[model samples]
Target: MAEKIFMKGCEAVAETAVRAGCRFFAGYPITPQNDVPEYFARRMPEVNGVFIQGESEVASSNMAYGAAAAGVRSMTSSSSCGISLKSEAISWMAGANLPVVIANFQRGGPGIGTIQPAQQDYLQATHASGNGGFRMLVLSPMNLQEAVDMTWQAFELADKYSKPVMLLMDGFTGTMMEPVELPEPLSEEEVAAIRASKTWAARGKHGGPQHKVMCGPGLDTRISQEQMNERDAELYESWKTTEVEYEDYMTGDAEIVLTAYGITGRIAKSAVKLLRAEGIRAGLIRPKKVYPFPDAAYEKLPLEKLRGIVSAEMSIPAQFAEDVERVVHGRTRIVTALSSGGEVLDRAAILDAARSLMK
Candidate 1:
């Protein structure tokens, strides 16, 4: 019987993954994200699943790689430092088209960043961690429920594309305790549906031709190039379906739109409520799907009358603001309000930006 439960978001991720029939969990413990692995370790054995606390984040990621190659639903979890170590393995898994789930419970910075939550890893999670060319399907979770729901769905998405999906949650959401209505466990038929498309997975033959899921290692360069193009096209198409999750409050006729997502969006929503109460005619644009960003969302916006778009981000240089600028298409001016070094944005700062825009 599926029911509401009080649990930390990280704990919910483990519960949800298990509910989705995940059979393998491999990860190195790193603060903020450690609860996820610990939960799996505690519960996985009950379901006859395997949860291994690897030697290191590097090993954890590779273990997931090996499990995915063996045709099992596997996952790994880490924060910034651990995520950095998963880079090479992530690249190899992508090249091999292995289906796996990895989560970056993002904490601040470049080297040994703090355990405090930060959105600074935006470039890392979306931009292939370290490698320059590859793209990863990065899903940003705003609340505990999204963390749990997206963790389960990540496996399905990964399996569908035969790629790795990162469920990016901040330290706040991961550690925050919340009550969520967890979905029911999938039926055996549903499990078979996931396995059916996994013909490319390394499952034993069922009286069918031999199967293979490999990288570009063919002697024929032309054929290898074609396959590479196909993978890129598929990744792009996947991005097209990405989303931004947010709730709009009283944005019907406002000229200046405040765009924020994730935890920042939650705070922005609060700002919206306060501003509305103060007789400020401000509207909010919250993007729930940050990647494959909700481009269609813009069609509903009034661009011409816009004074300027204020991008409220948890990091400096306005990581998301740049993307917002691209989608705005010069239809309006763009300004950014940032909280550097993984700092939280001041609510008054955002409200002031809105007040200034109206001037």
Candidate 2:
């Protein structure tokens, strides 16, 4: 039997990254996610992998980019502010088709708003993460166990698509501790095999031939840039068909359903149960994959049965609510139950909203 270990969500992510064959990690300390780098700084060395605490988030992102270009399973992580600093590198990585794992343990933020958990970065995570209109596979894990699982899968998805993959969560998810049965760690041989398979990895040519890995605007030529953009667009569209994940909880028989992600999704799930106990037919459409937005899941909902769709998140003006609105497409009235500035949405608040909407 797999032994369940009690671990903080942040530490679980770091440990799982290593187990997934990640050998290079660079990050700076940021509140709500500091334990990620802290764990990597200690564990990476033990595994004979490299860990660097860059002077700034920008530097950390570039360092991760370089490591990934060399075909190492590499990653960087930060809060929303730090992610903004890393944006340029992220855009560059996407252009280069570099596979890298990134995590955003978001905090309240327009500009350093608060350090407590909040889902204020929904727009940043899903719609416009970086320049050049690049899209990433964004996974928002609701619990420590899911965090571990998602972090483990992130490396594979990043490599498979040759693009950055984000593990998006909040401070509450990052700092919370829970019992989890982590997956088995990859062996040294297994890690080496994975690394060796990347034919483009930066190994010296022994003075024979040199290869170039370019991620710029492509030789300053219109044709080159156009070709690059088209290829990127194709990949982005492919994700819509290939990568979408969500959970449907009693939605089959529901009249009121809630939509949420990350920590807020967990809260909404609890709210669904509370409503159920009170004889309300509430359900939840909790998205595990935020980007590729899980639109198909929304389309699959029993629209004829739904009375209302409530978006439960912790953001002002409700960033994710915009996507939910688009998905619902005027089929039913949409509403929001939001808790901002580090506040968790009260379960009762969500329950009451669903009840009132049904009435």
Model 2, range 1-359, lDDT digits (tens) per residue? 68999999999999999999999999998898999999999999889999999999999999999999888899999999999999989988888888899999999889998998899999998888898888999999999999999999899999898889999989998999999888999999999888888876667665646565547557634348788888888988998988889998888888889989999899999888788888888889998999898888889887756889888899987999999889888988788998888887787778777877877
Output the lDDT of residue 269, model 1.
75
Clashes of 2: 0
Best by lDDT: 2
lDDT of 1: 0.77
Residue by residue across 79-136, what tens digits does model 1's lDDT show? 9888999987887787677888888888877687788887877767765564535666
CA lDDT of every candidate: 0.77, 0.89
